[model samples]
Target: MGMLKLEARHLLAAAGAAVMISAPASAATLEVHIGSFKNGGTIPSKYAFCVPAAEGHTTGGANINPRISWSKGPRGTKSYAIIVYDNKAPAEHREMMNKEGVTMTADIKRHNFYHWVLVDIPPNVTSIKEGADSNARVVHGKPATPSAAGVKGLNDYTKVMAANDATKGQYYGYDGPCPPWNDDVVHAYHFAVYALSASSLDLPKDFDGPAAEDAMKGKILAQGETVGLYTQNPTKGAKASK
Candidate 1:
């Protein structure tokens, strides 16, 4: 009877150890939404960088920032950061693109380009209204003043338009999609919202997407993302038929 009792105690201890080993760390949850378009859906032309227009003149889209919102962040989340990037841009010879007008092909390896970077979003703020940062063409350097919600960061458009005589300026805020018109592949724009533990990033005025991301490292409590598709080229069959 004594031996049986000892064995039962050992078995219970082993079971408890197993349970402890299998337990998972607490996870944070976040839900992201964009009212202008659905996840994995086609983005409207009005949100594109350049859209087909009359008189053979390519015109900029409505150039409005899409409405974005998120649910409550994790328990420790005190602020949020928004990043919009395109992972399908050609990686080769990006520096010479402006001077050479280099066209990116579908076969090349793609790289990321940051289109929008807004940071220090207050915990109480849950949404950004549409057209809040609208401009027909590119706008150079928005004031770095932090609003009640947050401040805007420099986007990749600043780099792209820096060499252009007419568009050259320190482009900031949201610049919509403007993928190559001849590429065979359609590009996807990823919009991510990160719940951060820090109340403010305290980033410098020159901070870009990468800068903001680096500052938020190890401070992120949760993250959620949505993708929107865009293309400057028409479908192959549709173009051929036309």
Candidate 2:
């Protein structure tokens, strides 16, 4: 009877130890940061495609890409991808856009407008300094090319600039916010980073945000983002919301 009781105590202890060993640890969160702009704060005009102009509604801006950084991913993270896009692009009443006598109200529906799409960033790389990718705006847009840092994907400016002959080109990499100057609402830009399981998604050189997102669908191990607000409208100042 004494031997059986000792055996039962040992079994219970072993079972408790097994449970503790098998339990998972708290998951680490991926954190993103932008050096030039605060999350949920105004994005400076220096990083915009257009800024408030004295003569009229707007004018060309410095258009510099802001500095971005992120925390290392959890174990098995092979690479990273960065995507920047405006989340409040007017989706309707396009005819009223930038018209002298009309206004694009805040009630108008909005859509996502890709400003930058870079992928296949090395696992060791965790930060991109300001102006490292783009120091100034290119007239016909920069070439969609691959470099040691990562691959630059085509931004939505490709379609937006299609109507103009001089600016009509494959607008690649970063082209900062240029929301309609006549708009009544402020726009939000999301700077997101994704830790990918695959080193390369083998994406084509002409890929866009949607394509990059599709490629990263199953391979994304973790993700994080920060939002910055911007507006070309003079009425809605830098800190204006809605």
Clashes (backbone N, CA, C under 3 Å), per candidate, total 0, 0
| Cα misplacement distance, residue 202 of candidate 2 (Å) | 0.7
Cα lDDT computed for each candidate against the true fold:
0.68, 0.78
Query: For model 2, what is the C-alpha lDDT against the true structure?
Result: 0.78
Model 2 Cα lDDT, one tens digit per residue, 89-148:
878887788889888986888777899899999999999889878778889898865544
The CA root-mean-square deviation of candidate 2, after full C-alpha superposition on the true structure, stands at 16.0
Q: What is the lDDT for 91 in model 1?
A: 73
lDDT of model 2, residue 71: 99
Q: Write model 1 residue lDDT over 53-136, tens digit each, in one string.
A: 333324566677888899888788899988888877767745533232445556777678888889989898888888776545
Task: Give the least accurate 10-residue stretch of model 1, judged by summed lDDT.
Answer: 15-24
